[model samples]
Target: MNNSLQDTLALVGRILLAWLFVPAGFGKIAGFSGAVGYATSVGLPLPEVGVAVGLLIELVGGLMLLVGFMTRPAAVLLAFFTLVASFFFHAYWSLPADQAMMQQLMFNKNIAISGGLLAFAAFGAGRWSLDAKRQRV
Candidate 1:
């Protein structure tokens, strides 16, 4: 594809992907205790600390991805986070008989999101990104 088309696609992908995390982070922030409880239920070591760190990564990293600032690094971090979440929280590999259909759906979605983040890491922020401007200087 031409440069302009590539740039537009990248920007749209970044926005859509980043928006996915923003509400999640905001939900954690809005329901701090519920987030803590959920984290604990998931057997996350140091539930409070994990929730804090996860929220920051989701919120700040999502914003950075959206703006294309530090896009490559942000994408890498988010991708890693997605992988971990998929395995641990989403239980992508575990086919528990008791798991609800929604749980299975979440697992698949997390895996897909991880793939998208990996794509961003590989293809980069494209022409319209702050990273591009920085690269030119």
Candidate 2:
């Protein structure tokens, strides 16, 4: 594809990826106690701290991805974060039969998202991004 097309695709990908994370981060902030409760229920050590870190990563890392600022690092961070979260939040193997299907779907979805993020980390943000602009300066 042409450079313009590639850049536009990258921009769109970043926007789509960020869409899932940014809103989730805000939701975590809005429902902090509930999030902590959920984390605790999941047996996460230091549930509050985990929630805080998740909030930061989802919000800040998501914004960084949307803007394509430090895209590689942000993508890498988000990718790993998503993978870890999938194991905790979407543990299909631990669920009963009916619930297992849904959890499996969610787990697969997160895996796909992580794959996209890893692609961004490996390739970069493209010409429409802040990372690209920074390179030019």
Candidate 3:
């Protein structure tokens, strides 16, 4: 593809990726107690802290991705975060058969999301990014 098309795709990709995380971060903030409770239920130690960390990653890291600022590091960080969350929250193997199906689906989805994030990390945010702008300076 041409550079212009490639740049547009990178911008769209960042927006799409940010859509999943930014809203989730806001939702966690809006339902702070519930998020903390969910973390506790999932047996994560320091549940409150975990929730706080998750929201920060989802929000801050997500914004960085949306703006294509430090895109590589942000994508890698988000990918790692997604993988960790999948293991903890979507542990399908530990669930009953009925619950396992949905959890398995979620786990696989997260895995796919992580793969996309990794692609961004490997390639970059393209010419539409702050990273690219900074490079020109």
Candidate 4:
């Protein structure tokens, strides 16, 4: 494929992926106490700090991905963050049987999302990105 087409595809992909994270981060901010509570309930130490870091990763990292600025690093950060989240929030094996299926599904989804993020980190944001612009300078 032409570089132009590839770049467009990368831009669109970044936008689509960021769509999931940006709003999620905003929602968490809106419900900060609730998020902290949820994090605590899931057994993470320092729930407040966890929620704060979560907001930064989801909101700031997501915006960086959306704009294709420092895309690979942002993607790498998000990938690690999501993987940790899956373990902490979706510990299906420890849950009761009835809730296990849904938790398992969520766990799998986080893994899939992290996989995509890793792929993006490897492939980069293409020619349309700020990273590309910097490379040309």
Evaluated at residue 41, the lDDT of candidate 4 is 94
Best by lDDT: 2
Candidate 4, residues 1-137, lDDT tens digits: the string is 99889989999989988998899899999999999999999999899999999999999999999988999999999999999999999999999999999999999999998998898999999888888899999
Query: How many residue pairs clash (N, CA or C atoms closer than 3 angstroms) in each of the candidate models, in the order given?
Result: 0, 0, 0, 0
**Candidate closest to the true structure, highest TM-score:** 2
- For 57-115, candidate 1 gives per-residue lDDT tens digits of 89999999999999888999998887777666866345566775667788888888888
Q: Considering only N, C-alpha and C atoms within 3 Å, which residue pairs clash in candidate 4? A: none
Query: Per-residue lDDT of 1-137 in model 2, one digit per residue for the tens?
Result: 99999999999999999999999999999999999999999888899999999999999999999999999999999999999999998999998998999999999999999999999999999999999999999
Evaluation by lDDT, superior candidate among 2 and 3: 2
Between candidates 1 and 2, the lDDT winner: 2
What is the C-alpha local distance difference test score of each model? Answer: 0.87, 0.97, 0.96, 0.93
Better of 3 and 4 by TM-score: 3
In model 4, which regions exceed 4 Å deviation?
none
How far residue 40's Cα lies from its native spot in candidate 4, in Å, is 1.1
lDDT accuracy of residue 83 in candidate 4: 94
Cα miss at 22, model 4 (Å)? 1.0
The C-alpha stretches of model 1 lying farther than 4 A from their native spots are 92-100
Cα RMSD for predicted model 1? 1.7
Ranking by TM-score: 2, 3, 4, 1
lDDT against true structure, model 1:
0.87
Question: Compared to the true structure, candidate 2 yields what TM-score?
Answer: 0.98
Q: Which TM-score value belongs to model 3?
A: 0.98
